[model samples]
Target chain A: MKGAVERVLRPEEIPQACDDLMKAGARLQMTYAWFPEPGQSVEVAYLAVTAPHEPFLFLRCSLPADSPHLQSLAPQIPLLGWYEREIQELCGVIFDGHPEPRPLVLHEGAHPSMPPLDPRYQPDEMMPFTSEPWDRPPVEGDDVQTLPFGPVRADVLESAQIFFYYIGEAILHCHPRLFFKHRGMEKRFEGTSPSLGVVLAERISGVDSIAHSLAYCQAIEAACGCEIPERARYLRTVLAELERLYNHLHYFGHLCHTTTLKVGEAQGKLLAEQSKQINGMLTGNRFLRGILKPGGLRRDLDLSTLPEMLNRLQPEITTYLRSMEETNSHLDRLITTGHLPLQTAYDQGATGPVKRASGIGRDLRGDHPYAAYDRLTMNIPVRTEGDAHARVQIRMEEIHESLSLIARAAKDIPEGPVSSEISYVSGGEGLGWCEGARGSTYYCVHLDDAGLLARVKIKSPSFSNWRVFPLTVHDTNMMDYAINEASFGLTMAGCDR
Target chain B: MPVWTLYGIRRGIATTSWPKKDGAVAQPEVLGLPRYHADRCRDNCRACADVCLPGALSFESCQTGERLALDYGKCIGCQLCTEACPNDALTKSNDWAFGVRNRDDLIWAEALKSPPAEEVTRKIQKYFGRSLHIRHVDAGSCNGCESELQALNNPYYNLHRLGIFFTPSPRFADLLLVTGPVTYAMQGPLRETYNAMPEPRWVMAMGTCAVSGGASGGGYSCGHGVEEFLPVDIYVPGCPPNPAAMIHALLLLLNRASQHVQGGQVAH
Candidate 1:
């Protein structure tokens, strides 16, 4: 919020502006559409970062509500394809000259009169689902057959359909039809008070509970020009790191399962459960929910017992990781599986661990430095392998980093007020970002006339990573598909939301 | 010996003897579903209902004027109501095991009595008392429910130890454990999974979402729980019910454990 610069541009100037930004080495972070005034005009904003630790640049273009049209930027910028497709489907904004423009969140049979995101739109009785084929790249060979995986996959996985063109073990092409879990999350945030909005944000992705709520709360805090107390900032950092620990451990366990290391998987999961138990002890909830509010924390946390608990769990995690590293079978499966090249990851706009693993050292914790992150010493883990092994190693290193961060935060936390009273500023817009367990989570909030939320656009890390994930899956074997996916630690809820 | 096996052996047994040994819990610090004390409610006090995001608590207009309708099935266990309550009507408790065979039992009502043990329970006990194969379908959960479901097979919970296993195929499954708010896209797949199951298969709604469409239920994409789409036999309601609660629900369906909750009240 402090360093973000905004510019209002003409609809015709978007393509040039995007080209200039791309030439300037700016990476597109988020693209979203909102109604400035009800039934009047549609405003589309593109947010990007030019350099590490630089202020975010926002380019806003307005289109008439009746005929909202914009020249497509997706052709030049591959990462903007999904964002453009989403805006096209949800806000009814047509991007002229877009390639392969298909419905992203909405499945084939869902036919709403106006876009479902439009305020005047009325939802039908039942949301229809049909197996209608979209434009998928043809893989035509007598041996190459198209196999449809699921909306209901095996085990306790999220609902998503994936199409794989394969010949024996070789994967020819990969297409993921996600968003089966789309709960209209952005629409649910409409007209809600900031406090209630936090509750909704926490549910957007249950795994990234702290990150989503933190970003949303930061956005509202920024809009209100509210600064939290020192203690609250440190505690926020602590909670986020705790979330990272559990998530990474869980991811490690799942990755092990995919590699067929049953014992390793069990051990990793048991450690994760212990980490969650520690979280439950710190906060009353296991998922670290119900504590984050707009101003700061809902309640003051007790850190007297945190250091000892974290210290005890830290050694177990070290041993677990060391053991995992030592497992040749596990290491062999991950070493070169799901190889995503550096150029592909960069071009596709990968974020969080995915980008970090691809040698991009752009961690929001160090670059942006929100919530006591600036106060602490930040050491980012980066790998250039751009494979499953690199991703796993990144998470492993991050777990250690998170533990150290929490320890340092707990030790140096200053005693003060945890929260500050927020005065809602009508028509205030703010953008907030945080480095989540998976990736950098962004939230841009616009307040309505009455100082309530008008439109909340969430750029979940998974939304970016999911877009970039299929790139790694292509040309990969069928045997390592699940392993590759597990190593990435992608969640459908985050993507769908 | 393999390093993993040795490492596991060194850690010793971490599994809790819950439902097997009395007073044993998975996590002691974690708070469960909010307990509603109807007698302590003040007249015209809708503090709990106002903050209830999922409409778990609401004032229902009954014959005797408006009465507070409390449904644990829709509760995500956020405990906002307990904090907002001026009087101690809604209190926080460790009532994590809220699994019930009867759907109506989750809705709170004064003097609501539990019906006698059904003949169906005995039949289920006869069929799946020893070993139960479960096929889980994630309707449209936030992966919170999936996280907990995955925890059931972990070293601590060890669901397979209790003879309850998550089978990959529905053909061999004795129970279809469904989670999430039953999103529209998932209804077809869910029905197909249920239909594919063998005869005498039971449906257990695993979380608040599956029970009564947690927070995202009745939204544009998803319906209110699995009950709307399928005949649910057991309703376990937590935001994402802890691993222990899921085990209790499975055991309850098999008539291995007695129902602890009746009319949303935890029996001592």
Candidate 2:
């Protein structure tokens, strides 16, 4: 509200405005929807982060129902390519002249003929995994051959198909087929009471449960016009930073693991285990689920062991990551592999550590500043290399910053009621966001008149960052694939959902 | 290089001595399955079942009266049923040691009896008694289960210490440990993986999602669980069962331990 200027434009005006806005230094966070009645019309929203000036530009427009289309922004905003395709598949809205309009979320034959968002759509009794809607983009070289990996992979947690058209050790072209983990998460959110939908939001991504729930709660809080207690915000800052600390430690460790660094992987797991255990001490669940409601978190800070756990966390991370940094054999594997240029990072809408490591001095925590970020110094470590090494370095730097932030917030959390009072009526729409470990995670909440969630569009940071995966693999040899993939730290579930 | 190696060595072994030592991972208020006391349920009570999102708790018409049915497989340990139960019929407990031999051990309030222990085929015990290799399939989990699964390898849990390891290849694996609600798209791959495992292979449902579809059960593009498609040897219940809980489940599978909490013990 402080710096953002909202505009309601017609379909015809969007291209001109978006074109001008991009030129004026506004970067697209995500383009999402709150469309209830599909055939009549649809309202598409563009959330742009206009840095060094107004924090955001909330541009929205309603396209006519008959055509159910708008001029494609895919060409201008290359990041919009997947976002547009997702809307087409998930919401059934076609963007006229979109570049790659083939379905994004669903495997081609995973669903029935009807679009998922259609009111009358019924799932087939037998959803056989038949054939893909489209083929992997063909690599046109005599020596190049296609080798497809996954939907199921070795030693990996989530599911996504990576088609590498390569020649021996040189990766020529890579195409990623995701949504093997899509459970129609947005579709699942519909019809559930907004109050109860927090469970759905919490499970959207396991590791980022707190941030996801906060984003959902904030949107509902915005609808209710409720201001949470100061104590609650500080508590949120503590847990969210804790989430970031463990995830980074896990990522850094896994990056080491790709090089067959046994001790590195074990240390990473050890630090991550500490984070999860501490989370269990603070909240009931290890994953920090069920900690938030629309008004505030369901529980308060467990201060009995807070000081002790924080003390343990800081040194473990410092000792482990610092030692790993000094290990040259490890550095030899990471430094030059998977280098991403700043231009490609911007053009593909790469986000989080991947973008930050490429010397893009932009972070939602420092730019838009949500939760308790404004009260913090918010030091974001930046690097120009944009390689596997930079990603690890950036994460290590943030872990140190996060540890201190948790300590400061724990000390400063005021004595006050954590929950708030809010009337839960419907016919409301609002945006909720957090600077999750991966990047800026956004949730667009729209509640219908009956207090039912009409639509909840979650744009996970992984959704944008996953776009850069294929591009990054081209930088390093094929042997570094595992290291490169883990370095990215993108979640298949979050991206697919 | 020597510095990191020395740091690791000086750090000493971080492994937990669980099964050897008394519980090391349990914390106060850490959630597991709800302990049900049928005697405490009020007459005509269906409150707990109503708030049960995954249909984990439900009532059925019986000649005696409406009877409560608790399916541990469907339960995500949300504790909503425990909170909603007016008579304290369902109470909170940290007794997460819920790895059982039979699928029927997961369902309760049906004549209030545990599944016969004989349901675990003797062949499985003979084949995997001392050592076991597991091939994990993420049928359709939220990645929460995977997080815990990864932790099993870390120094703290050190699953390998117990003679259990996660094999990347199914051909070499003896047990197929599956997580998630078993989405439709993954059904084919899941069946293929199970089929590839050599004979005497066992299926272990790792989380409530794979156990009984958890919260996202009965949705479009999802099967309620792996049990529907394949015979499961064990059921471990949690939103994503913790590392300790999962270890207990695996041990129980190999007959290394016994089930501790009895079904339907009415509180005094």
Give the candidate number with the greatest DockQ: 1
TM-score, model 1 to reference: 0.98
| Candidate 1 C-alpha error for residue A369, in Å | 0.8
- What digit string (tens of lDDT, one per residue) describes model 1 on residues A67-119? 99998888889899999999998899999999867778888877656776776
Model 2 stretches with alpha carbons more than 4 Å out = A1-5, A52-55, A64-66, A111-113, A119-129, A132-134, B26-29, B43-47, B63-67, B119-121, B261-268
Off by over 4 Å in 1: A1-3, A123-135, B62-65, B114-117
Which residue pairs collide, candidate 2? A40-A65
Judge candidate 1 at residue A71 and give its lDDT.
89
Cα DockQ of the candidate 1 complex: 0.67
Candidate 2 overall lDDT versus native: 0.79
Candidate 1, residue A343: CA error in Å? Answer: 1.2
Top TM-score hit:
1
Can you write out model 2's per-residue Cα lDDT over A1-497, one digit (the tens) per residue? Answer: 11246799987899999899889877887887656665667788888877653546788888765566778899989998888888777666678988776767777776655566554454323344675555555568788878888776787478777888888888877788787777777877777777678888888888888878888888888776888889888888888888998898788767777888888888888888878888887887888876788888776766557867789667777778777877788888888888899999998988898899998978777877667788878688899999989988888888888888988888877888888886776787777778889987888777778888888888898988999878888635688888888888988778876
